[model samples]
Target: MRITDLNPHGGIGANSLFVELGPFKVLVDAGMSPKHEGNEAIPRLDLIDREPLDLILLTHCHLDHLGAMPVALRNHPNVPLVMTPASRVIAQRMLHNSHNVMVRQREENGVRDYPLYRRQEIEQMTGRIFPLAPDNPRFFSSLDGDTMTLTYHHAGHIPGAAGFTLEYHHRKIFFTGDVLFDDMQTLPGATFPREQVDTLVLETTRGASGRPPGYSRDKEVGQLVQAIRETLEGGGSVLLPTFALGRMQEVFSIIHRSMGQRQLPRVPVFASGLGVDLCDYFDQIARKTKAVDFRRQILKDLKVQRLPHGYKPGQRLPGPAIYVLSSGMMVEHTPSYIAAVNLLGDARNLVAFVGYCDPDTPGGLLQQAAEGEYFLFEVLDKRAMLAARRMRFDLSGHADRDELLAFALDLEPRAVVLTHGDPEARDWFADQLRTARPKMQILDPTPLEPVEV
Candidate 1:
């Protein structure tokens, strides 16, 4: 058996991995990298153009994991795919939306374009995706009467996220698809059953540095609530720029729950744009998961609208409201741009960041802003404005140090291969793991770099 990476390893984006075991050729996640001039970074995987792939397995619906699905399917339309049921739904939405953006970006960037697949390609991808329900055993019959039993386990990173195990030819390989830390709020933590394994493909997004002992998601949220309350009591609006999914729902639920416990003031808590739709989506998901109160509260608050997409200053915000808007990183098109333009220079308003941001983005600039640096930010490409204090809190969706180490130690696999991380994070994790298990084989290959087992 062999595994190969097919894109650059550093910075975010363009994630593709190919695995081969006897006659089985499994292509894992294929994603777009930020470094790609446009959509060109979506790997061609032409190396396997002539080889027959047995299956394709998706980690989750994140663009970096499934961005190249359409292209892959166009090149090999008959290959079967597998993922969690909820991910299949999100994948279709995310991919179709991304394809639109890809087309526009390509045209704007003046990049050489090819005959890329269309929305129909996304539909075809969905049609072939066989749901691999958690803990259920399914057999993939081999050409020589040998069988591969595939199992999916909840990864606890997002709703419907999974870590999978494949038993083939008496060797077990465990794939951790974007594992999460114990601090996550919305989903349960990842579970790794003890099993003998030859290889463990893990993610090192949060494994480089160790977190302090005794950290709790509840404590973090409590501190954030206190901070928000202080800002609100001081007569300021709290501007939380968050991703449309995951952290957005987690933060909303946390704030709603805090209000229920009387731990928060009844500020006008609102979310703008597609964020409104996501709440409904979460409600539906929570219902399926038997989450009673969360679903009811989210459904009840469906009517509360925040400031709309293009509100300007002197145009008035909807009172002392707490606005949770989309495009978490304040990427140009999101509502955060509107808020930054309208709310800047107002010492009373606070822009609180909750996730990672690219350095080129407005949110990233806000995060890296110095103490005396005056930010001239713009919304709708209109007049720029200056802002006062901006705050950032690490409400990440990835696993922390202890959680990463715990996963590796608990699994006790024969070898470990790190993927979906930058070189620094990957090296840091591999170095840390060596101290605990010196004999374990650690592989961190560049895109298209293959490893044999």
Candidate 2:
């Protein structure tokens, strides 16, 4: 078996993998990097520009994993796309929003290569997508009499996220896309198969950090609610920078339950962007597939409002309200970034982070900031004192490292390959795996480099 990591620049951006087993050639995902723009942001599809791809599998609908699917289809126009039924429904909406965001970027950032694939391109390829059910394997054959079966399982990271296995000639390889094992408020945890496989390809997203002893997700969530209560009671507002796909909805559900139980005061809840629009899609997924527990009515109950205009730093801004905004990293020009400038200078306000924040993004910078340090809002071209209290809750979407290590060992693979993590994170997993089994073959693949297993 041969596999290539297609993400150029590597380490959790533009996540795509190319696997070649006998006569079958498949592409796992084609993602756009949130950290980079235009051509630099996508995987190196140029490597397979002239190659024949039999299938393009989508692991989920998050932009980092599903963003460049249209471009991949445009490149290998004959290839069939595969995903979960929910992802089939969610992917279109996500891709359309991605196209809209790219168009806006073209005008705002002048990255001429924005809008990498057109709307018609997306529409043209819809007929080829197959939404297969979990545990049911689909067979594909090559002219040379080679047959392979593909099977998917619940990954439990987002509404439609999945992990899959490919079996060829009795040998099996399972790929764990972004995964979470513990159930959250709105979604159930993973229900993956426990069978052993020949090769295991894992995602090491949370390897670098270990959950402290006695840490509890419920306690963390309660603390988040407590923080909001204190902030509001103190006549301050709260800003929760979240990923529009999964994290925002999770927070909404938490807030909904809290308000219903009278744990949190019913104040005006503010949110907008792709996350808000996705409420309709989540509602449909919930009612139809029962994969998620979100509904559009939650917004009606919360009275979520679009942020009012004219929020200038150091001026009076929205008061005593809870704000949940997208671009979890607080990327420039996003709602969270703009709101941060207005909220940071005040001691009465609070900014809480409930997910992973990359150290390079503005959100990460803010997390590292001191109480009175001046933070530069590069896009706004202003520096403000970060007096607002900031805290990080342990509500990560990825599973803990120990849980993943135990999971990898349970698979009992002859060889292991790591994907989707920073350099340090992958290193930690490698070290632990080596310590556990001194002679095991663990491959930390270099980007664009093919390794035989």
Candidate 3:
């Protein structure tokens, strides 16, 4: 088997992989980088010009995985896109939203290459996509007339996320896209194959961090509730910066349940426009696919209001409101980032992060800032003191290092390839895997580099 890392910058952004098993050529998860602009943000699809792709498999609809699909489809016009049935609707909606964002950025940020792919192109590609039901083996034939079987497993990271297995020529390979082994408020834990494979392609997102002793999901949830309750009861607003898709829904579910149990004060819960839109989509997903355990009704019952407009930075917002906004990393121009500047100067408010934040992002910088240090918001030309409390919860959507290692070893694969992590994170996994079983082959392929398995 030949596998190449298609992500140009490597690490956690623009994740795409080209794998060849016997005669079958497969492209997994064409993605665009969040930190980059225009064409550079996308995967290096030029490398695959020599050979036409036979098929494309989408593990999930996260922007890093689904954002570049229309671009990839344009490159390989004949390739048929495949994904779990649950990802069908969300993928299209996300692509449309992405196009709108691109159009907006083209004007605001002066990114001339914005709207990389047209909406009509996405519509054309939609007709070619086929949704495969999970946990069932389906046969696909390559150009050379070789047959391969594909099966997908539920990956607990987010709604519609999946880990897939490939069987060809008596060799089996498994690919775990962003995965979470533990369950959350709105999703169940992963249910992957507990069998042997020839190769295991695993995500190393959390390889650098270990779960603290006595750390459990329930305990963390309890602590988060306690913090929010304390802040709200003290006449201070709480802001949770989260991703619009999965993290927003999960946090809402937690908040809703906590309020029902009378653990949280019933204050006005505010959400960004995208968050409110996703609630409807998630509701449809829950009713149609049952892939997630979310109900839009709860959000409505909680009185989740659309975030009010005409608010300027440094102005004190109406007190004791819980604001759930998007752009989890608090990127410039995002609702969360703008709100941060408004809320951070107040000693009474709390800004809590409920998901992973890349070290280079504004969210990470704020987390590392001292309580009294001044932080800069470059784009907005604003500066504020770190007066409000900032806290990070262990509500990540990826699996911990130990759990990932155990899963890789349990597969008993001959070779393992690490993806979706920073250099230090990947190095940690490489060291631990080598120490555990020196005979096993562990390959951390550099960007665009091919490795033979």
Candidate 4:
């Protein structure tokens, strides 16, 4: 088997892999880099010459894993695109939302090549997506008369996220696409097959951070609740800048349960951006799959208020409430960025971050700023005083470093390839794995580089 990393940059975003086994050539994912713009955001598909892929396997509906599916499909229109049922629903909405964003950018930001793929193209691609039930093995015959089988295991990062197993010629290969072993507020952790494989493609998102010292998921949630209660008691609002997909749904579930149990005050909870649509999609998936215990309609039962279309930022809120907005990193022009400007002048208001933020992002800069300091707001081209309370929680969707290492050890694969992590994260995993299994072959290939197994 031969595998190549399609990302132009070796780091996390734009995660795509090309795998060639027997007579079949498969593309694992076609993603876009959130940090880049226009054509630069997409994977290096030019290298593949839009070749006719035997199959395209999508792990989840997250933008970083599924954003560029329409672009890939445009090249290989006949290729069979496969994913979970819930992911199919989510991916369609995500792509449609992304198209709207691109349209707005073209008109507002003066982007020349904004809309990479048209809405009609996205619809065409969506129609070809084939949903595969979890744990069901499907066999196919390759061009060379070789039998190939595929199976999906629940990945547990999001509603329909999955890790896939591919079997061919008496050899098994496993790909752990963005996984989490610990349960989240809305979803249970993943359960992988115990059988060993010859090759393992693993993710290293949190390898550099490792496990938090004396920290657990329950403790993190408790801390968030305490912080919210304190802010609300002080007559201040809380702003949670989260990703519109998995992170948004998870945070909403937590706040809903906390209020029901009276662990948190019954303050009004508001949601905006594409997250609101994603919640609806989550509700649909919950009703269809029963994969999660969504006892009641989350938006209705939790009483989440949707922000109106003409609502202006920094406008006086009715009272102490919780606002969950998108663009987790607080990118320019996003709802969280606008809300932060309005709330930063008030000492009582709090902005809580619940996931990873790159240092170059607006959210990371705000996190680093000290109280009473001035931060330049690039979007508005002005500087503002940092006075709002800031807090970060370890409520990540990725598996802890120790959990990933333990899983790798259990699999005992002949070779391991680490992807979807920064250089420091990959290095940390390499050193730890080398120490644990001295003779094990661990590979971390550069972008566009191919490794044979």
Tens digit of lDDT per residue, candidate 2, span 19-90? Answer: 999889999999999889999999999999888988899999988898998889888877889998889878
Summarize candidate 3's per-residue lDDT along 1-453 as a digit string, tens digits.
999999999887789999998888899999889889998899998889667788899999998998888888888887789998778868888888889999999999899998999899888977878888779899998656789999999998988999999999889999999899898889998999889999999899888779999999889989999999999988889999999888899999999999999999899998884767888888988998899999989888899887777767666667699999998889778889988887898888899899888788999899999989989999989998999988989988998899989999999989899999989999999999899989989999989989999
lDDT value, residue 269 of candidate 2: 95
Where is model 3 more than 4 Å wrong at Cα? none
Query: Which residues of candidate 2, in runs, are more than 4 Å off?
Result: 309-315
Query: Could you estimate the TM-score for every candidate?
Result: 0.91, 0.97, 0.97, 0.97
- Each prediction's Cα RMSD? 2.6, 1.5, 1.4, 1.5
**How does candidate 3 score on lDDT?**
0.89
Top-scoring candidate (lDDT):
2
The C-alpha stretches of model 4 lying farther than 4 A from their native spots are none
Ranked by lDDT, the better of candidates 1 and 2 is 2
Better of 1 and 3 by lDDT: 3
TM-score of 3: 0.97
Residue-level lDDT of model 1, residues 1-453, one tens digit each, is 788887654445767788887777888877766456554667757777777777788887777788877777666777888887767646777776677666776675565552255777777775788887788878997666767888988777777778888888788899888877463656777765766688898888865566667667667777788878887887878888888767777778777777778887787777776556666666666666522124536525533566765566435676466888877888765677766666666777778888878778878887777654566555454543445458767677788866777778777877898887767788887887888899988887756667875
- Superposed Cα deviation of residue 242, candidate 3 (Å): 0.7
lDDT of each: 0.73, 0.91, 0.89, 0.86
